[model samples]
Target: MINRDLIEVFSDIAREKNVERSELATILEELFLYVIEKEYGDSSNCSCIVNLDKGEIEIYSEKTIVKEVDDYKVEITLEEAIGKEPDAEGDLDVGDVFVEVIDPRIFGRRLVTTAKQFFAQRLRDIERNYIYEDYINRVGEIVIGAVHQIQGGNVFINIDKTELRMPRNEQILAERYRRGDTIRAVIKSVEFTSKGPDIVISRSDNHFLYKLFEMEVPEIEDGIIDITAIARHPGSRAKIIVKSNDRRIDPVGACVGMRGSRIQAIVRELNNEKIDIINSSEQAEILVSRALSPAKPVQLFIDDDKNYCIALFEDENLDAAIGKNGMNVNLASKVTE
Candidate 1:
């Protein structure tokens, strides 16, 4: 009855945590062995088998029959051995192997409590591993989650029963997140920590913008358009260079969508941050000029050896080219590079 109740409780928790049945069995076996070792001082001769389907756990201890027991963990006296199995009295002799079935109840209430704690911790570890493995493969992909916690300018988002962290640096400065607010970001990185997996998500990353474009534009996802480079000041402005594999499709127009619907959606998601999509070019001058949109340079002189360009812009366009805090020219340089 104890075994049934224990198995039922643990099975429910494991299933809730999405732990595999096989993994739960392994954890159960390990838990029993741990308890056995703690009680007997040694579990080397002990084996635990778990049948989750039957809700049964069997523990066995292998010991050698001896005339006198010195180490009770591995040796049992013949008198004691026969006492356990009277039918085999004639066959049982000194040095013969005795198999003893252990009742888990014998471990007492104290040990059972300890076992529960151990099982809970094991489930937590398994949950951490599952979160790590799932998110590690999803780096650079966008995830939408609800804000669950806020501490020290860090946001904790809950999605699919897992919590993701967005640190202050990864969050958009202009955005304000509140509890229960739905937020979207890209999986920036996954790191293993002693407490658990530290799943760091980001909204300020350049890849966030790239992924937004990918989500909004089917041509980009379909391989019709390739985003060549991205430079972002996050919450402010971003520039992306795109190349069209199919000559018939206009990469910029496809990304813009009909009546600016696609780009508008992305802009709204990003808190109205401006985005400039430039067509990629093999020629450095053409690419740089396109990168500096809304402020065309009068002339551009490229120095291939120095890997630099000198742009001559009209006085009226100089302020626009440089942008607020020189962000425009810096992004242009980054995208062109």
Candidate 2:
């Protein structure tokens, strides 16, 4: 009688833990073999037979045929071998190996339970490793998830394989998350904790803008144009510096799309935040001038030693240069940095 109940229990565990059934069976097999070795002494020539249909287990021990038995667990004399095998003397030699059947019940209930616990712990380790590897490579990439819970002012989201906490500091002030609402965030980092690997996700991160723009514009995805730098005020405004590898392609126009269609999509995703797509330049003055867009800079004073530059603009365009609450200049400084 195969223990259908035992198999079913394992099936339930596999489903709950997101593990493969075959992998669970392999872990159990290795656990049993280890238990058998601990109970019996030497297992260099040991084998386990699992009969799931019969709900039976059999362990066999192999002992070497030797002229003199130095270790009783691994070796047997010719006379002893012959006693176990009637015609062993005619077909066996002193250096040969033979199998002996051993009772599986000898391991006892306590040992079997201990082995099961060991198997469970190993399963947890495998699960942790799988999660770590899954999220580590996704750092700085965007993922779509649904809000699962709100606790202590922190939002928890459910993504593909695990839950991520959007720290209160990493969230946008204008954004509100409710249960079942789908949201997009960038994976800022992955940290290993005592419990498991913890993934830190963010909606305010600069990479969030890069990822959204890439999704909205095909030129960026095709490598014709690429984001060289990004700065975000999150929920308010952002600036992205782009460069085209091919001279024929206009980086700014490509990102802005035809009549602002592509940029509108990105704006909708970002809650209507203002975005300034600037062309990247290798020269410091041109880069600073481009970083302060909409309001053209009249002059740029670069101080390489102090690592700062002063941007001069007319009084009429001062508000455009500084933006609301100095947001534009702040984002420009971040972009230049």
Candidate 3:
């Protein structure tokens, strides 16, 4: 009855933690071994079995039958061995191995408390491993979650019962998060930590903008249009260079969608960040010229050896070419580079 009750309690916790039944059984076996080790100072001669089907746990201790018991944990007197199994009175002799069954009740309440602690910790470790394995393969994928906490400029989002962290540096500067607010971000990294997997999400990452474009534009997802390069100022502005495999389809137009619907959706998701989609070109001068959009350069001097381009713009267009804080020129450089 005690064994059944114990298994029931553990199984309930295991279900809540999403731990596999087989894993729970393995943990139960180890937990009992830990308890035995604490009680006897050693568990090398002990073995534990957990039967989930029957909700039973069986513990067995191997002891050597001797003329007299020296170490009670590993050795037992012949008389005691015979007393445990009367049917093997003649078969059991000195120097023979005697197997003794341990009663769960013998562990008492104190040991049960210890086992609970061990079991809880094992479940936590299993949960941590599960979270790590799940998110590691999902890096760079977009996840929409509710903001669960905001502390020290970091946002904690909850998605499918898992909490993901978005550090201040990874979040858009213009975005404000409150508890229960819906948020979307890309899984930037998954790192193992002592507490659990450190799943860092990002909204300001270049890949986040790429993923947003991919989601908004079916052409990008279907490989009809490929985004070759991307540069972002996060909540301010972003630029992407795209190429169309099928000449009939214009990459920039496809990304923009009909009446600017697709690009508008993405822009709204990103808190109205400006996005410039430039069609990729094979010619260096053409590509650089397209990258510096909204400001046409009068002449561009290319230094192929240094991988540099010096653009000469009209005096009035210089400010637009450079953009606020040189954001335009910096993004153009990134795209061309």
Best by lDDT: 3
**Superposed model 1: Cα runs more than 4 Å off:** 1-3
lDDT of 1 by residue, 297-326 (tens): 999999999999999999999999999999
- Give the runs in model 2 whose Cα sits over 4 Å from its true position: 1-22, 33-102, 106-121, 304-306
Candidate 3 local lDDT, 1-337, one digit each (tens): 3458778889999999989999999999999899989888999999998889998888999999989778999999999888889999989888899999988788789777998899989988998899999999999999999999999988999998889999999999988888999998999999999879999999999999999899999888999999999999998999999999999999999999899999999999999999999999999999999999889999999999999999999999999999999999999999889
Query: Best to worst by TM-score, what's the order?
Result: 3, 1, 2
lDDT of each: 0.91, 0.83, 0.93
Backbone clash count for every predicted candidate, in the order shown: 0, 1, 0
User: What TM value does model 1 have?
Assistant: 0.92
Ten consecutive residues with minimal summed lDDT in candidate 1? Answer: 1-10
Better of 1 and 2 by lDDT: 1
For model 1 the local lDDT of residue 166 reads: 98
RMSD of each: 2.1, 4.8, 1.6
- lDDT string for model 2 (1-337, tens) is 2335655665577678888756766765666678766765557677776654455556677888889888877888888888888865698788888777766556568555876687788778878888889899989889899999999988989877578889988899898889999988999999888888888898888888888888988888998898988999888899999999999999999999899999999888888888999999989899888888888998889998998999888999999999989988999999888
